[model samples]
Target: MAVGLLFLVCAGAVLYSAEAQDPYSELPDYYKRGVDLALEQLNSHAGVHHHFRFLRSLDKSDIESGFGVRYLYHHFYLKPTRCAKGTTESNPQTCPFRNDRPLMDCAVCYKAAEDQIEPSPKPYVHCIQKPRLTQDMRTARTDHCKKMTYNSGAPTLLAVSTG
Candidate 1:
């Protein structure tokens, strides 16, 4: 029975770690706009059938490049939404997340300066698709997509650790 107890302890620790890794949900609008800009670039380049929504930020940093120029670096997660790509509905917030699709780990960096031109240079964005979602990601999806339900027709996928 000691082995069984140890297994339970280990499982609890793993769950806690996942929860602890989640970033803050209450971010300022300035940071959220950064996420939107990243999404715009990501959706444009991605070949995926569905558009991805910003799930949560993993980390962020603001560094002054020079002479009043600030560089914003954002690392975040993106989850596939029910809305199809190139749809007339421009708002990803209205679309529900698809549990069947893979989660995306993404990072974007861009210059933010008050004197910058109207159309700032495209942010440098890179993303990798993770085959499975972490516990924290699932929790975030649930909270973020609370306004809509998951697609019933899509097959429910399980989250397996790649590690």
Candidate 2:
């Protein structure tokens, strides 16, 4: 009885650890799809040179926009990879992260619905570059991005946006 109990405990612990390591695994299929589409959009932006990989999700929200439509919002962090933009030789998964470039904090908002005849709504992509790696600098940048309003102007090192 004791041996069986020990085995069950070990199995449970292992499963819990696996879940903790990949928070994305718990997200719904639609959410995962949204993240992939958002990442692709982020990479295609002219301001982005090197490829970036998803680091972690900062925030997310799902809102019912009346009828069958729903709005999805995802805010996440991205780290630059060694691969250059539009590089056919390497992908984000295989490319190692580059320490030289600044980190990106991005937010994507889009609409989702079933049996929709109209074209999908254009996604809103906004990314803020965090050049400094210091803890205080990161906090300040995060705070600044949270407060700043979205802009549709030309891209800069400090901000990149697409609609």
Candidate 3:
């Protein structure tokens, strides 16, 4: 009986570790978010409450759900500007982002959109603009990111930019 219990414990540990270490599980948080967006779109049944909360968030409160979809937040320019490359810029286009950590970059990104940043003290990114993006602009902007992430393996706007 004791061996059976011990075997169960060991089996559980192996399963848990395997789940944690699965190569498919290695994608960053924003990648997971992109997947969630696709899943959310596919599920179409996750309901409006969360979507409303995200849309209504004066600050994008629920975006943190991006378990591996971090890359979605990166902003690109048709032309690179003087923004420094190694620190968090209140604006990625006009400022700098410290590449020390991708999450830090994500935080800085939230600051610019200011639409979504988990309500927090000392949040890394701070919005300097009133987020003038209209609903159309926001949709366009988000779609840009989503497209890039969803079709990362395919040619993208950035690719067009560079091409």
- RMSD in order of candidates: 16.6, 9.0, 18.3
Instruction: Flag regions of model 1 displaced more than 4 Å.
Output: 1-26, 64-68, 88-90, 115-122, 131-163
- lDDT per residue, candidate 2, 96-163, as tens digits? 77888777866655566752222345555656685534566555544544443333431221233221
Model 3 weakest lDDT span, ten residues long: 48-57
Number of the candidate with higher TM-score, 1 or 3: 1
TM-score of each: 0.54, 0.54, 0.22
Q: Best-fitting candidate, measured by lDDT?
A: 2
Model 3 per-residue lDDT tens digits across residues 40-119: 33224433111100111121222322343222243211111234223325533333223332120011222112232232
Pitting candidate 2 against candidate 3, the one with the higher lDDT is 2
Q: How well does candidate 2 score on lDDT at residue 30? A: 50
The lDDT of each candidate is: 0.60, 0.61, 0.31
- Scored by lDDT, model 3 comes in at 0.31
Task: Give the 10-residue window scoring lowest on summed lDDT in candidate 1.
Answer: 154-163
